[model samples]
Target chain A: MTHLVVVGASLAGLRAVEAVRRDGFDGEVTLVGAEEHLPYDRPPLSKEYLAAEECPDPRYREEETFAGDLDVALLLGTPASALDTAGRTIAVGDRTLSWDGLVIATGAHARTLPGTEHLEGVHTVRTLDDAVALRAALRGGARRLTVVGAGFIGSEVGAVGRKLGLEVTILEALETPLARAVGERMGRALTHLHRRHGTEVRTGVAVEEVLSSDGRVTGVRLGDGTEVDTDVLVVGIGASPATDWLDGSGLTIDDGVVADETLAAADGVYVAGDVARWPNALFSDVAGGTMRLEHWTSAADQGGRAARHAVDPAAAKPYETVPYFWSDWYDGRVQFVGIAPEGADEQIEVVAGDDAQGGPFTAIYRAGDRIVGALAVDMPAEVMKYRRLIGGRKTWADALELAEQRRVQRAQKQAAKERGEGA
Target chain B: MRINVDWDRCTGMGMCESLAPDVFEVDDDGSLILHTEEISADQEGEVREAVAACPTEALSLDGPIDA
Candidate 1:
């Protein structure tokens, strides 16, 4: 039997084990995770889980599920300390496990602010335990909550704070929220959303220190020496790939484990999930020359794809998929399914409803005559049509017409279905 | 047919909407929203085109559409 060893018991690691079995691999698979708890979803950590709206359930397979369903061995709570790539062994604590193949799904770690140690109420959301702690803090009815970053996680948490009836103030070092990812316009849109929902979002401000007295966080001091009083401080600056274990593993570790389109690094080693920085055809203009995404669902998807290629090299292909991400904040659900690069020339082809009232709309990102990406809000049917147009690489003129045609066709289909003619 | 969305594989690159506008949509916050649970035979060509056009191979059609 092929002995496969996977490190980092995250969404990616769990899915990799499942993918191996799904791809007809009856091999001896061992999954090693750092966390003691079973693999659960992380996206909910910031939203529903943080708000106490839902408890953390086993989103992915547990030890019993893996052992019974896939017949895979799971090593929980033990992290892989070292990778002996040449020797084909992984050092976990004092014991070394041998493997015919290795999959490194060790996801990234949330970047935290210095001096945040032992400071009560200063938290970062990455793991289930972190979410549980943060949720407990919120349940205590903290007077004011200060989020240190304006990125996705911070913004989502800020939205949650407002929903929970807490005074939420966000401190962003950049001029706008999500400046690095979605440019000024979309960021401004989000800023508007936050402001409208009663969250205090301060841009161009930096967190100099997390203020505390008697090991309990009281507030944060800004770079300008202005102190904002608060009981909770959540930092969501960003993340760094969990590649410290591979210090001498001979694989290139830039921002993440450098892999090609096939997610292959060296001869017997492979990387996937947020820890692996693979070539991205969609966002090729980024400075890193590759994209390292650290989302929950995406990590699982990449893990499965990488596992398939690792099990059978003949089935390997370039990793290409339309990037899709969603966030539920306040009363509205925001979703993006395409590259909305910073400063890309965008054209508004279809606006389904009134923007002021929060309705469906589609904005097409265009570079010359070619449609590079699409942004949709509320208009699910129109967004669906635009998704197809983007994939087909259709021209602007053709895409517009198709969008109109699709609207009409969908209405007809819905009417037909309602009349019991299309069911 | 089960429509599979590899969320990690997706870069929020909206191609699915273009090919089968009747089936796939992007939500307000920029995630793929599926309009139909199952696709029809007539929509298969466009669906395939959308899937193939996915820069990340995030979209997949499993089994038969009628199934």
Candidate 2:
């Protein structure tokens, strides 16, 4: 029997094993995870998991599904220490497991503030344990919350802190927060969303040092010799791909485990999730280069696609997608689709709604003549439509036409609602 | 199969609509619109794929319903 060993029992790892069985691979499968808990959703960790009075169980499925239905051996809480790709063996703690097919879905680790690893009030939300601890700190009489980075995670955490009635402050080194993901214009608008709430946002400032007293975090020292006092400090700087175990495994590694369009990192080995850096065929012509998406949707999609290619190489096709991700802050949702263009010929415009107001709006990103990406503020259905256009490599004109159609639709809906009220 | 969405958990991520557009749609107001709750046998594979793709774990497939 073909025994497939899937490393990382998170979202990608769980989907990888499921895909293997779904594709009629009756092979013996062993799933190894660093955490003891079965596969659970991670997005909620920074949002709902942190805000809720009682923590919610976010497991994708129960324990019985993996053990009984999937018929796979579970090795939880034991992280893979090393990989011998030539011999097809993986070292997990003290045990060495051999496999015919391998799926590396190890994912990424949250980048914490240097020298604050042992600090009492410092936290990063990458795992369930991390979220639980952060939630406790937030609820445990934390009067002031300071987030080092103004990224999605930091923004969400800061938003939650405000909801919990804590004084919140966000520090970002970039001139404009979320500029890389949503362009300068939209990023500035999003930064306003934080200020609209009671949260204080300071841009173009770096945390020079983390200050602590009695082994607990007290505040942060800014680059310009200024200090911000805080009871809880969240380092949402970002993450580094967990590729330390594959140091000499011969798989090409840059920012992440480099893979081809097929997601094959090596012979009989596939990579998926946040760790897999592969060229998405959808933007092959856009010159966006190889991409690594940290979105939950991409993780699950790439996991299943990589597993199927591993099982049957002959039936493999190049994996392609219009990458998508959504972040919830306060009462609004921020969604982005496809890769945003950089440098010259890049155009970003508010296609629908008013960008001036801190309300619902849709912005489309363009490169040359084609629509490359879109950022939506509380505009969900409209954004997905643009995603389809991006996937089809539609022109800028096409995007404009679609935007007009949506505007008309919205107007008609509003008019009908008004007519009903008048009657 | 009967498609069920936990309205409480569904944040209109549109993963289901992306996988099986015919069965599901996210409206202008950002809420999921189930075109048909009772899906046919032929639609089972893609419907299952849609159910699996939901990030929020909101979508569920129930019954090969009794004829």
Candidate 3:
């Protein structure tokens, strides 16, 4: 049997094993992970799990499921110390494991500020344990929570903090919350959402140091020589791909493990998940060469795709899925599909509903006459419709008409359901 | 037969509900709420289109179907 050695037993790694099995590959599959725990979902760690919402049973999967259903050899708590690509073996601590095929789904690590590690109240949410620890700190009803970096994780945690009735203040070095991804317009809209939810969102501010006394967090010092007293400090600056183990692995490691369009790195080796920055058809031109995403769901999709390709390279196609992401702040659900270029040079056409209350609205991003991307706020149906329109390369007029038609159809269906046509 | 949406994967872009209204619906917070567990034979084509149209690949058919 061909031995498939998959490093990094994350969501992506676990899913890859399943995909390999589903692809009819009756082979020996070994899944290695640095963390001792079984593969669990990470997105909920910051949102639902922190809110103490049952933590979602079977966070990812039980070990028994992997053993019985997938027939995967789970090597928990063992880190891949190094990769000998030429030799086609991975050095996991004292043992050397050979492989007919290899998959690098190491994923990314939470970036933290220096000197904040020893601080008691300073926390970063990445793994299940991180969420458990943060939840424990939040349950204590900390007087205030200072969040560094107003990115998605920070903002989401801040939203949870406000919901938990904790005094929350977010320090963002950028002028807007998501200025890098969504331009100032959308970023400002998110900023408004944060402010509306009673979060003290401070933009263009930097945290100089996390002040701690007796190994406990006292407060944080701002770059402007001001001190903000807080019991807890959450750092959400960003994440770096965990590719240090591949230093001499001969695999290309840029921001992540660089793979071809098919997600293959070299012979008998593949990359997937957040750790693999592969060429994406959607953002290839805009992102220079390749795009690296840390999305939980995308990683799973990529894992499945990579596994299929690794099992049978002749049957694989290039990884070209539409880019999609979402943010849940307060009661508002902000979802975006496709890449809206910087200074997209487009007008916002077809505002579906009222925007005053932040209800359902679809902002069509156009470059001249072409619809490049769609931003939907509280309008999943329209967003779903537009996703097809965008993927099909539908004309702007057709997309607009489709959006309108779907809206009317939804209303009619709801009316019929209420009248007992369909329960 | 049915569309299973991994909510974690769902960006709430709402593509599935739009293409196949007979199948999918959105909650108050814009998260996808499946209306029916199994799609009628008539709505399969639309549901399949909706699944393919999903940008995030969040929507997938429950059972065997021609993709």
Candidate 4:
């Protein structure tokens, strides 16, 4: 039997293992995870898991799934220390394990504030322990919270803080929150929801330093020399792919483990999820190079594709996906499809419904005449519609027309819902 | 090639329309409207890609590619 070894007990790792079996590979599979607990969902750590009234286990699969449902071995809590490609083996602490095929799904880790590493009440959420600890801190009455980034993770954390009734303030270094992902115009629209939910949205600024007293973080100083007092600090700066273990393994590593269009890293080794950085022909056209997306859907899709490639290299196909992600803040929801305008050539802002507060709108990014990206606020169905357009290689004119149609339809639906409630 | 949609499975994500607007369109009310069921030689590649991109597994191709 061809034994396949997968590193990182993550969504990608789990999905890949499941995919190979589903495709009838019948190969021996072993999953090596760094975390002590079983694989669990990560997105909910910032939303549902963080905001839950009662804390619950976030395991992606139950005990039975590993024991009986799947034909796989689980090595939890220990990380692969090194990879020896020539010998086809990986070092997990003291023991050396051999494999016929290897998968590098060692995803990224949450970045930390420069000076707050050792300080109390400072956290970077990437694992179950981090989420559980953060939830405990909130439940333990830590107030006047401050978040250092306004990107997806930071914004979601800020919203969760507000839900817990913490005085939350989010600081973004860019001109707008999610400016790099959605563009300035639409990113500005997202700020409206934060204000309505009692979270301070401060843009065009950055967290300069974490204020500490007696080894506990008390506040943060912004780039403008303004100080904001806080009892808890959440650093949502960004992430770097965990490719350090492959140091002497000779795999090309730039921002991530460089992979080919087929998600192949080497002759017999493959990579997937946030760690696999490869050129996406569709989105990379205007952006100019490869990109690594760190969304849940990307992990799931690429995991299956990578596993398929691993099982039968001869039948491998280039991995191409229309990236999608959804976020929630209070009563509002934001969904993004394809790359944002920043990744494309030109940005075309479109509004369909009279939302009165910039809550409902669609902005499409165009590279020449082709629709390259889109951002939809409180409009998921439209995001899906735009995804089809982007995949279809439709023109900007078509996107604008479709946005107008969605806007009018959404407005009518909202009015009808209101009328129904009144009656 | 011919295209068949499992209407029950289609979430109306409309990624198909995004792939080949000439072939597919998902309206605002979350309904799918296929422009045509027949896939031309030129559109076979994109049409196949759209089927793969469908998140809900609602799309499938019935015949061999003319290309």
Candidate 5:
């Protein structure tokens, strides 16, 4: 019987196991996770999970989904400390387990900021326990809070902290929060969303030092000679792939695990999620090079694709799909699709919405005639519409009319709602 | 194949329409507008992908003609 060993029993690892079974692979499957608890969703840890003191369950699927429903064994708590890729064996403490096929779905870890190594009240939200700890600190009546990095995690954390009645301040090193993902114009719109949520936004500011009192984080000193005081500090700096175990294992490791478009890491070894930085076809379909997406949806989709390729490498299709993600700040939602054109963004961006009142508009990115990327605030449908346009490689100049029509329709609907006429 | 969408469960995320544009369409405010009730064979795969890809798990697939 073929034995499949999967490391990092996360969204990617769990879904990879399910994919293997769904593909009719009657093999002995084992999942190794570092965390002691069952597989839980991570996206909510910064949103709904932090919205209230008592929250809904964060587990992706019920235990029944893994118990009798799937033919797999769960090995939680112990991580794969070492791997002999050539020998097809992974060392988990004293146990030496070999596999017919291996998967490296270890995901990524939160990057820690300097000078906060042993400071109390400094936290990151990468795991369920981290969320619990942060929530506990906030619920314990921590008045003032400061968040580093205005990325999705930082933005969401700031929003949730305000919901918990904490005075929150978000600091971003870049001029705009999400410049890399949504470009500067759209990022400014998103920044307004955070500011509208009662969270103070500071940009182009670097936290040079973590001010502590008796080994507890008191605040952060900015590079621009500004000092922000806080009782609790949440670090959303970002994350790097959990590739420490694969050191000297002979697999190519760049920023993350470098893989081909097919998501194959090595011969029988495949990778998924934040760890696997494969050249994506969604972005490269129009342009030429590779891209990596760390969103939850991308991980789930790519995990399944990676497993199928691992099972039947010859019959597998290259993973090709539009990358998408959503971030809910206060009452407004920001949905983005595809990759934004790097460097010269102004020449390619054709925006169609106003950034007023938390920005309920859509901005489309184009490369030549075809659409490349899109960012919509409170315009989920437009994100979807543009995603199809980008996927279909449809010309954006042609769809601008439809975009205009939708804008008028939305304005009418909003007017009706304001006049107490529409639902 | 027959396509079904649970609006109560749909958060108007637009995963379906964006993924399988031929079958489903969403409005500017993320309201659903069914374009095609019966999915073509070629689009079945894409529709199923959309259904699976829905974050809320609000989409389901049913098919193979009752006859």
Candidate 6:
């Protein structure tokens, strides 16, 4: 391959370009991004960036240094319009670029409510621009913040709003926040974490209509006719994979651009990041093989893997990973690794600290005899151990053993600390 | 080669520890403990992986160590 084209100068796209150089591909590399800014970290947008008095610099590398070091041609502020698989060409803005190999990392766009698109004071935290605007609104003397969605983004925004001393309220359509993903019991336990910090979490409610005045949002009307008064509204309803440009491109499009076990959408065309949906053999038994992750870690891993495979197809290996993601809310940290297999009989057990007291805890999700997932809140080290176990497809009994070991070690450490303090 | 960590960007996520257990560790209170700053030839691959895997982009590799 003489020339390589990476679509979506995102986290995945940047990594793909880096991997190409690392794999000794001394060819022309072009990275196209919709935004003008260089590749920056997105996780901080909702956390520190929003909470801080000044926005923190989140760029992975400087634009000039990155381009000079990688010898890449960056097409920033230019979004790819379409793809031509047969001709191996992509439409970026007014120009058409041909490639010997392509990595599609278009990623996803934040989903907004239907009627609220034109309303002011409504924000979504998917991109840096979105976060910046939202942070400005928060710091611009906005009194009340109403978040429409109890998912990670919504919860984090609510937490940050509360930290800024705003009256924050989180609305969830489901009876329990994250009930489907983390089970009802654990979901309530997590939602309670924000409540401890003075964020009102209203469950089993949907936004019936967004009330506005003078082209600006004032509040939202609930499904039950109750209205909330607010100065700003945030719609964290989630996101859809940015695959609209790939229409009729001949690649199978399901929830995302469906790829094979090798992450190849077609010959010489590989897909990565949130836009690529492929069969992860790691969770084949649990999720029926098909999986797509929107996490930062997976994007980095799959970006490099897809690039390496595109450069050298013969040495390519199937991309199997123990999916991992972490979220920061209030004074606690939430992390989850591995797939919580969807089924009626799936079990959730708290093997670590007590969950009822609203403190630190680790819960393992089981599918029959095998441990499929683990969720850790404020237990970082123990979570990594469970991630290893989940990747190995270990059993419930094995997880229990590990939990017991952790308990014994914790007790020993506590006793030693007490002895030292006594002396 | 030497590994340089941007302490301001590091949140003690322990991703480096997970990728290269021998090179890094996260204490109980979520403080990062770097065992070694210099990277050996044998451990370069995993250390590079750890740097790339870091979500915050806080870890970076400098040029080769001086003689």
- What is the TM-score of each candidate's chain B when compared with the real chain B? 0.82, 0.91, 0.82, 0.91, 0.85, 0.91
Distance from true location, Cα of A245 in model 3, Å: 0.5
Candidate 3: C-alpha RMSD after superposition: 4.2
Off by over 4 Å in 5: A285-287, A348-351, A356-358, A408-423, B1-9, B31-43, B62-67
The regions of model 6 sitting more than 4 angstroms off are A343-346, B1-3, B35-42, B62-67
Query: What's the residue-level lDDT of B1 in candidate 6?
Result: 90
Sorted by lDDT (best first), the order is 2, 6, 5, 4, 3, 1
Residue range A128-233, candidate 5, lDDT tens digits: 9899988888778799989999999999889888888899999999987788887777778788887777899999998889999999999989998889999999
Q: Per-residue CA lDDT of candidate 6, range A181-295, in tens?
A: 6677778889879888889999999899999999999999999999999999999888899999999799999989999999999988899999999999977776685888999
**Cα lDDT of all candidates, in order?**
0.74, 0.88, 0.78, 0.80, 0.81, 0.87
- Please give, as one word, the docking class of candidate 5: medium
Order of quality (DockQ): 5, 2, 6, 3, 1, 4
Worst 10 residues of 4 chain A by lDDT: A347-356
Q: Which is the better candidate, 3 or 5, if ranked by TM-score?
A: 5
Best by lDDT: 2
lDDT of 2: 0.88
| lDDT of predicted model 6 | 0.87
Candidate 5 chain A worst ten-residue window by lDDT: A343-352
Expressed as tens digits, the lDDT of each residue in A244-357 for candidate 3 is 999988889899999999999988788988899888875454445788888754777788888878777778798876666777777667777666667642445545764444
Candidates 2 and 4: which is better by DockQ?
Answer: 2
Q: Per-residue CA lDDT of candidate 4, range A1-423, in tens?
A: 398888988888988887787677777888899988888878778776888898666776886897676888999889899998889899998989998878889999888877678898998778889988888877788878888889888888899899888999998888777767777666777788788788998888877788899999899888889899998888888999999999999889998999888998887788989899988877665667888989877887788788778778888888877788777677566778888655332355665543236666667778767887777676545777777788777898998888778768777978988999999
Docking class for model 6 is: acceptable
Off by over 4 Å in 1: A53-56, A282-288, A345-361, A380-384, A403-423, B1-67
